[model samples]
Target: VNILTTLILVWYSPDAKADAPQWTFLLCALGLFAYQSLDAIDGKQARRTNSSTPLGELFDHGCDSISTVFVAISACIAVQLGYNPSWMFFQCFCATTLFYCAHWQTYVSGTLRFGKVDVTEAQFTIIFIHVISGIFGPSIWSTKITSLDVLPLRFATVAMTIVCGSVSLFSIFSVVFTGGVGKNGSTVAGTSVLSPVIPLSFVIIPACIICLKSVQNVYENHPVLYIMAFGLATAKVANRLVVAHMTKNEMEYFDSVLVGPVMLFLNQYFNFYIDEYYVLCLCTLWVIFDLMRYSAIVCMEICDYLSIDLFHIPLVDHPITQLNKNGTTINSSVVNTGSRQTRSRRHHH
Candidate 1:
């Protein structure tokens, strides 16, 4: 999805590849509108059912994470940032990095707050920006902000960058102060007591690579980059799921709003090419496979969580028996006696 969405921008960039027709904006706007509308309903439905499971949370965050990239691509298109690499890097960095910061915040603070406007809330606002740009033209965002006289997009992007930057800074520093009494009498490990860096490297390393490659554009084929990025993204999401499950914490998904403007700056200053399709295919397929594997693991874990039967029904009954060549007999009672004894010696979820 990361590669696909990025390609969409490359092909449609009027200033960069210029492969897309003039009507690209209409198509993109409509797709974004439909997606955002449907996205809004998912949370409502989850609430209506009063069932918020790990799967639902994963689905929500997974979609939001992927869509965050798409939103950046679209915003860059709207602002005519296709030919600017510096801005492109900044935009991608802003979106991806800020989001990672949000998760990190929850991990350290043990709480997630929106302050009235969160990523999802800002998503609709961004969609509105795309719609206006699509209709009145991308130039609208470039128009100066009244009184301030700065370009609207410029002012908005700078303001967002500052605010989100501060939040990220706070979260990063909070890691050092985490240990204390937690909900349900659980101990919250503070950075002073312990550092989750090793485990968290599973989250940070790939993120750094993604933001770096997005800025560099050195790979003729982006397979290595995309595969690493997607795999890490999924793992990071799963990490949150596991932590939330074990800690019984709740979190919300959000995207950094400044990616669009940062992308504009990158394009305006140092435009680079990212249309390496074959490499993208490799990366996308790898991530898709990773998700499949992740799903299987999750299913198994869920079954274990519920203590659902995994072995055949015959194993549940004592009468089912198998006779060996001579006189030996294998039955559920004998099999379970040993297995159950072994299992009893271990721990369970």
Candidate 2:
């Protein structure tokens, strides 16, 4: 399946080999569609045949991740070696990082969920944007202003790049701080205690700047790209708010309603080209990290159900723990139970 997926991706990849004819792009697209179709089939096969072992699950995920990376890289290379701007490759890299950060944030929070019945707003938007851009290309909406002709497509590309860069930076910081706490408690590098203020301050300041910039761009140019960029930035900020609130309060359906539109908007506007191979590779690494983390959680849950004790698990030695210990009988079972309860409570919402 992995080999098949790779071959399909390569064939569908827009990046043309110097030795190959121009018709290869068409062949590549067809192969990509076939590969995607097979992606669905493999999952069904695993379920129907009762072959859903941990290794099988891992392999499936690995293949999916690799295929995505291959597509991204191919797009980048196609642009680099073909008709697209060279700088577009950098944009692709940033976009891939943005995707990874979003994925990481969800996985680390233990709220990672996947489905086929429902299309995620991000996925839907991206697919829509790809189709529209492919059909319309550079002539989507052309307007002229005082000695200058502006293309909406170019604006869209630029806006997407800016949004991708901003979001990627935000995601990197948020994931580092939050995931650090999850893995090592309040302190990072065994020192420098992390406070709510640290992350909140870091995230909010830059977010405010970006939002203001986006708003300014919208007012000055009123380009469709700026609007889309603003939406992406707003959605990311809103997501952070939702996550923080979820940590403290109940999850609400209304929150989804509020945030869903921005995600949908971003997905529809974000574009990928053959010039972002490096960026796509980086995203693949990010996805691997996320999948590994998710797999770790799954393994731990399985161990708990099977009554198997994994050796030497790292425990977060928070200040609260020190305060709770008062030279009383150190009941190991009580400690374990307390830890498990706390973890469960943290993840429940």
Candidate 3:
């Protein structure tokens, strides 16, 4: 829903201009709030349905990885940061990088830690920014504060993100460098502590180099597309990190999702045989498909191996013997009906 609403806003204001209609921002706020509410409840729902498994954790974090990208983009658009593609780029990548670092540390520490001011708070802050933008106007972000430097309110978000990101990075690095649960202070998969950086660089390095070197200014012209492509690429790697943590498997540095960025980089290297914008469009499409395909395949594989269903609660009914009023015994069998069954087995799908 958040992605859909963001697309609507993009349609209304392709560049997220300050003069875009107020309704677009309101829609974005509602969508993000809905996303946050749903994300919070999903775990509870899983536990309630007795379907909680390792797969549930994987799926939850996987969705979060993808949502981080959309939320960051929407937030940047809400603040009219598209006017400054550099800041917009930093904001979006900052979000993805922080998210990746969180899991990267988890990959080492074998635990997911949340700080006092964590994801929930950050999400609410973005929602508030959307509300204010919707109520006042996107132009309000450009209003200069009474400071010696006369900074815009939008720049305040950049400052806050930098501080928060710095603290988070510090905490994550402390965990990663200190040691892992494995022998000799390695990662959970017993790989090098610094191995995760290689995949991350595959996303960030190409993004910076390609965007900076593009003769056609593809990124500056279409910041949303460029960011979304790289964002999904980043999410793919982050998801792999989660998988590695959960399964205790070594994560390879090379990822198929890197193909998208590589294409853009090669296009720049070739001096734009084809239009860079078209390549970006193709890159976006490919990354979206690749993420979905990989996620679906992984979920299906896990479900099959665990004898579980991804979306449904599996119920097994057992027979019960009851005593009759007349002192006779009555035997009743609980059939394998649908979800309304009153009896369940020890193992759930």
lDDT of candidate 2 at residue 309, scale 0 to 100:
43
- What TM-score, computed on C-alpha atoms, does each candidate reach? 0.56, 0.37, 0.91
Candidate 1 error regions (>4 Å): 1-11, 14-43, 139-159, 168-284, 307-349
Error of 3 at 282 (Å): 0.9
User: Model 1's lDDT to the true fold?
Assistant: 0.49
- What is the lDDT for 30 in model 3? 92
TM-score of 1: 0.56
Q: What lDDT does each candidate get? A: 0.49, 0.37, 0.87
Ranked candidates, highest lDDT first: 3, 1, 2
What is the model-wide C-alpha lDDT for candidate 3?
0.87
RMSD of 2: 19.3
Q: Candidate 2, after superposition: displacement of residue 342 in Å?
A: 50
Which ten contiguous residues of candidate 3 have the minimum total lDDT? 340-349
> What is the overall TM-score of model 2 with all chains considered together?
0.37
